[model samples]
Target: MMLLPDAEQLLANLTERMRSGVATDTAIVGIHTGGAWLAERLHHDLKLPLPLGTLDISFYRDDFDKIGLHAQVRPSDISFEVEGSHIILVDDVLYTGRTIRAALNELFDYGRPSSIRLAALIDRGGRELPIAPQYVGATLALPSDKMLALEKSSTGKLSLRLYDKNPMGHEQ
Candidate 1:
């Protein structure tokens, strides 16, 4: 069994790294689900001025035709201006980079930002694309068959879970 690292500690470390690097005008946006959860904590801890934003890249996903719609697709919420503002796109795991690509495509629809940086809680090295994270909590290597996920408790505690991917499940 793979021993998982502490998610709270990882987030704490990631927050510190982001604190020094981000500009005061930087806006934070989290990918839906795990990324959104992480972004919520980071946004509060970092005390950003802009309202927090989230992306639901379901429609923008390259595999939308292949996979069809996700059961729980939520609308993206970006209340602040996108143009000329620095953006830090947050995600729970950085793997194939497809999700980030989809997110970028969606974000541009709002308007071009001055810059967009990536922040991931875990960087699992299996990249089909050339994308990478500027701020990361941890770097891990696992078999392709294994999956890692971020979990949040009802009381808002965070944890990591590693498990075998279903044989029929599509890769993220």
Candidate 2:
């Protein structure tokens, strides 16, 4: 079994980096369930002025046709003006880069931001696109058939879960 990364320590490192790195007009936006959770924590940790925003990129995904729709698709909410705002886009894992691409498309729909930075707790390398995270907690090389995910406990603690796909490409 793969050891889970230290969520609390990773957040501390990310916070330390953002202290000097974030611009004055920066806004935090999380990519969905897991990302939203992280953004909430980061926003509180950094004491950001702007409200934390969340994006549900279910509609903007390229593989929507093949995978169909998600059961719970929450509407994206960005209260602040995105124009000229610097955005910190948060995610639990960085894999194929498809999610970030979809997130970019959705984010632009709100308005154009001055810049956007990608942050992830884990970067499991298997990129099908040219996307890379600006801030990452750790990078791990996993087999193509294995998938990594973040799971939050009832008390709001975080852990990593690895699922292995069988020879037939079915998740175990």
Q: What tens-digit string does per-residue lDDT give for candidate 2 at 53-103?
A: 999998988877766777789989899899888999999888889899999
In model 1, pairs of residues that clash are: none
Error of 1 at 38 (Å): 0.7
Number of the predicted model whose TM-score against the real structure is largest: 1
Clashes of each: 0, 0
In lDDT terms, how accurate is model 1?
Answer: 0.91
- Candidate 1's TM-score reads 0.97
Evaluated with lDDT, which candidate comes out highest? 1
TM-score of 2: 0.91
Q: CA RMSD for every model? A: 1.0, 2.6
In order of appearance, the predictions have TM-scores of 0.97, 0.91
